[model samples]
Target: MNTSSEPGDSLEKQAGISLREARQTQLLKVFLVMSVIYTLYLAKTLFIPLVFSAFVALLLSPLVALGRKIYIPRTISAFVLIGLLIAPFSFLGVELVKPAERWMETLPKISAQITEQINEISEKFEQEQNQAEIQAEAERKQKEAEEASFFDNWFKDDEPEAKVEEVKEVKENVVTGQIKQGSIEIFLSLLASAPFLIAQMFGSVILILFLLIFGPVLFKIFIQDFPVVVDKERTVQLVGQIQKRLSNYIITISMINGLLGIATATAFYFLGVEDAILWGALVGMLNFVPYLGGLISCTILLMVGVVQYGLVSAAFLPPAVFLGINILESQFITPAVLGQSFRLNPLIIILWLAVMGWLWGVIGVLLAVPILVCIKIILEHLDVLPHWVKLLESEG
Candidate 1:
């Protein structure tokens, strides 16, 4: 009866119901997402390795496919590929140990040099302060004399001589015993944890190997099990595109970083910096991290420069050269190679780095960009979140 009596009232009621349902759906989605994020944070120890393995599998998928085309067994191909990837890094680690130790030994001397420089600067500042005080006192006395009349000057009491106090140095004795004990404890803790860390590393390596070998099969099963609402052909195409694009991005970026590292090492060698190769390798690896990487590379270079060259203007050369190279690479080479499609908003990248870095420390920072890239790809393919996907992209 009411529907027949008033069409507008019924339409308004339907609209209100639809609006409430839509809002409820959105709120549920938001709650579910927050729950997932909290779970990820809580389970990071278990999840980080799995996530890393997935990315590593994605990176190696193309090579594994090529191996299949050549009739090579997946197991054999995965082993060979993983070995090829790990060998150089293992060798680099070994080679870097001696240099790292040498630098560690020199740390005391470097500290002393820095302390001396600070003392010199403080002394200069003190001298300047003293000179300013003397000038100010003279001006004050002059003003007093000028302000006084002839009779007033005669009647004024004799001014006493100003006394300057000598600055006293305080020397406190540090308890070396406690310091040594603390260092020993730290060393012992690290030694105790070494086995666990090694085990975890091996576990990750094994996981990565298995994933590389069976990733395609796992993907196929996932596709089969996907909801019927999602078009199977579109899902397959999306997965393929993600694999190809992500692998290509990783490979291209690695080559660029390698070139940058080589150039940096060569420059450092020519400049007579110690542990050039180690620093170069570190720079290259850290370059995987976005903005923070360049800053870290510059800082390390600057420290090396100061230690070697003793704080001269030339001491800045290494960091300057590094920063220049990084600018060239990040601004021109990287953008040109990655193209517009791969470009990401810097703000989002930094935020992603901060979150992941907080969750998993350095490893998370290293994985942040790749993880973000993968997420961006998935979001782009999902028609439901076009706005979120657009937010991840570069503005221009």
Candidate 2:
């Protein structure tokens, strides 16, 4: 034992730990750098016109190139594409406003319906809690209702009136506390911001239009002199792949979203819902977001349905419809079309929506996934990035 190389073993262990610690430190440094870069990108977004221009340019670049192939002038091709894209939305808004305004008046009733459905869910939960306490009582007779998990723990359909009443009393406060949507100040604030909001609206549209026109030319100029590579060939290749991938993504998403809108509109029409067209259009537009967008569409529809139907029984329609649509989209369309395309995990996508929704509101949520995908794509192609770095950026 005295002759054992104890000191050598200790040294080896120490060395290994030191190496691991150093590697960890290096990783932390890298994380810090990446965070700073993303922060810069977020800051740069206030100048969103430039970003919009880039995406538009990428989307139209292929078409513009095709135009050149057939001897069409690049400038003319850009203008034609912009007109084709912008004209539809412009027409839709003009026609849609009258119907949309008529529907807006139902907002209060819709909100009340949503509150009622929530109350039902809360009662069901309270009954379950009451059943659990009965089960825990030592003197209570062994009953069938006493056994179950949390879902069971909180939702026993059968419970004594006394027990149910007790549970109801406790949960009344808890349930009421959860019903926080808006205060007077929040509504007032929104009303106050209406002018600035209107200006931002026009600014965003004008920004989008400008991007559509000169986006490609700007892209060419931006990449013409890259700091990373000296050879023009590699640089051109990089730019081409980026444009192609982005354009392909956009075109595919647009087609899918359009179909979704049509499908949703058709379903709502059959359901005898009011303003079905507007709701469907909303669903279709939001459908671009994958899992999270679908949820929002479902929530809005549920609220409207609950408001219209005005009963616990009627409230079930929204979730039922939601489940069916999700089943079809997830089991079929997503796997077949958008599977490898998004590659990002559903949870991450949800989180991205939530974060963006918080920072930039609805527009933020709308743009989050696309922006994230773009960032992932760019990071993926960066040669200097490590495997782990690439892995994080990769679609799931």
Candidate 3:
């Protein structure tokens, strides 16, 4: 009887320790996860490329599969497709360069126009203010005699000329040469990283070629062995769905921008805005980045508007037009085409663009939405995350 009680107590003690140990083990795993997450944050430069490449792969997979369906060799199809895509891009590249060339030839003219417009607007404002001031001055003179009696008595009480001397001493003091300095270090840093743009473009083109050529092989390797408890078929299905959805997204967005560019360029040309084609192309391209794009377009329009229309309403017109088109796209076209399920929350999308812009700049902003879309899809399918949570995180 004593032996039986002692044995049971010993077993209970071991089991209690095992529970505590299990808890400690789980905590250790959580700590490791947190460390890894922080490490990724710190090492984002390297990681951004991987993320970009993965999303790019997801985008291009559909086209690759289409090529396969049509019985074209992967390498040939990739080359042909890329070549076709490159034509418009190459045209755009040419357009970007054209502004620089024209600037060289017409710098003096542009400077003169900008100066003339600024002076004209300033003078107009000054004239209006002067007219109002004259009217006020006349009014003040009529009232001055009435108001001066009390002041005059007060001034006589002080000394007759004391007030005049005080008035004479109150001269305006203007500060000169108060130039705020900008950091050469930051300027040089920006200059140094300018190469990254070229590197990114080259890297992307190469990545495209590489994926197109070896995508199937790479896909197999990537998913062949996994650490998680997901099924292989499910993995492939997710990838396929992601790929199809993303590629269509890329294609659709690209087309929308292209059409918008053409429409805007035509409008600009009709409005007699200089470099209409260039501005239009920029409007189309930059608008892909969301909030910032509209801002940039508006700024450019305001500058050109001052010269073109010279009216205050004219100054507001371009931005308002941009806002209107955006409203249309957001309300009707985008929802109908991209569908509600595929859309992203505006605030999250904007924040994503800003983060990416900070990390990799404009290029990153361009990719941010796509990368977020892919991540949202993966999170949506995960059972660990609830349906409501996924819906909130998703395009919904």
Best by lDDT: 1
Report lDDT (Cα) of residue 340, candidate 3.
58
TM-score of each: 0.80, 0.68, 0.68
Q: lDDT of each model, Cα atoms only? A: 0.82, 0.68, 0.68
Q: Is candidate 1 or candidate 2 better by lDDT?
A: 1
Question: Over the stretch 225-254, how does candidate 2's per-residue lDDT look in tens digits?
Answer: 655556767767876776777777777778
* Model 2 lDDT at residue 300: 78
Error of 2 at 382 (Å): 3.5
Candidate 2, lDDT over the whole model: 0.68
lDDT of 3 at 112: 54
Could you say which candidate leads in TM-score? 1
lDDT of 3 at 146: 70
Residue range 314-365, candidate 1, lDDT tens digits: 8899999888888999989998989987878889999999999988877899
For model 1, the superposed segments whose C-alpha errors exceed 4 Å read: 1-27, 130-197, 225-230
RMSD of 2: 10.2
Candidate 3 lDDT over 1-396, as tens digits, reads: 998799899999999999999999999999998897677667776666666666666666667778889898888877876787679789878867877465444434544555555556665775676657666765666576577786664543423244433443342111111111122344456668879867866777777778778978866876876556358888888767766777787778878877777877786677667777877777888878766777787787676665557656766666566567666765777668887556666777777777777766566787777777767666666555666444545552
Deviation of model 2 at 88, angstroms? 1.7
- Model 2 lowest lDDT segment of ten: 176-185
